[model samples]
Target: MDLDRASSELNEKLSAIGGTANVAVLKSVVTQASSAIPVMPLYIAMVFKKMREEGVHEGCMEQIYRMFSQRLYKADGTAPEVDDQNRLRLDDWELRDDIQQHCRDLWPQITSENLKELTDYQEYKDEFLSLFGFGIEGIDYEADVNPNVAFDVIDI
Candidate 1:
């Protein structure tokens, strides 16, 4: 459901517990799948540069593909992601219609070599995760998770 509908439902549930209109409700978030990522800003410089120079600018899908095509593979017809981890990212399949159109529009004359460097999704996923302060280079996950800490600011 949409944000307003979810928030109203949340308020209704809170009312059942005599908790409606609590100030904390304003700060609470209903978990959502489409929250914006902060990492794209950092890559703006590179993306704009690529767009201007190579005329190859892309959003998440294309960028993921580009990552794969570049760092993850070479000229021959070999697919990796089928490695020991058995970690299969359906990034190619995840390329939505609009996104594919956007990519084609950006570089209508794309070459075979260009399309080959398609995605380093796992690496991209790691970079995306690190943006939320959860997976830093120095932090140790096993040593750290403090259960006593509440999930929200009010509880803290």
Candidate 2:
């Protein structure tokens, strides 16, 4: 696929939101699946950079918080609501006041030079690595290790 054109088109759509948009570029740590794809990592990173510049970058935690806390409730504080198709309102949570406020506080302080130190991207990367038995902080990757997985049939 044309990564540049795709990325540009996505950014253009985001820009059309007029700064009132809650559009967030969802990214996670690199995984075996993503690493196997030729351009996935670079594409994700570029999209992340663009979204950051657009002040719409958000991590997984933020997305989860928005999903559960902001979208599940009814305006009358009674029954849960859903979309026209009855699907969960997952995408709208980033527009919440607290979430936006928190993002606003962090977004301006992020920079390319200090992205690792300043943003949760590093942590997300580490978490992603951990899923594949890598990138755990305080764990020695240089040492020999044993990796195993055992699943209980009934419980699992």
Give candidate 2's root-mean-square deviation (CA, Å): 12.3
- Residue pairs of candidate 2 with colliding backbone atoms: none
User: For this target, which candidate reaches the highest lDDT against the unseen true structure?
Assistant: 2
Q: lDDT (0-100) at residue 97 of candidate 2?
A: 61
**lDDT for each candidate structure:** 0.42, 0.54
Model 2 C-alpha lDDT versus the unseen true structure: 0.54
Instruction: Give Cα distance to truth, residue 99, candidate 1, Å.
Output: 11
lDDT of 1 by residue, 57-89 (tens): 455556556546742464674544432322333
Candidate 2 structure quality by residue, lDDT tens digits, 1-156? 354455456656877773212222334335678766884554444444445655766666766666556554445555445544334444443344654465556666667787665554554466467778887668887998768768777954
Candidate 2 worst ten-residue window by lDDT: 18-27
- What residue pairs are clashing in model 1? 65-118, 68-118, 68-119, 68-120, 69-116, 69-117, 69-118, 70-117
**Predictions: Cα RMSD each:** 20.0, 12.3
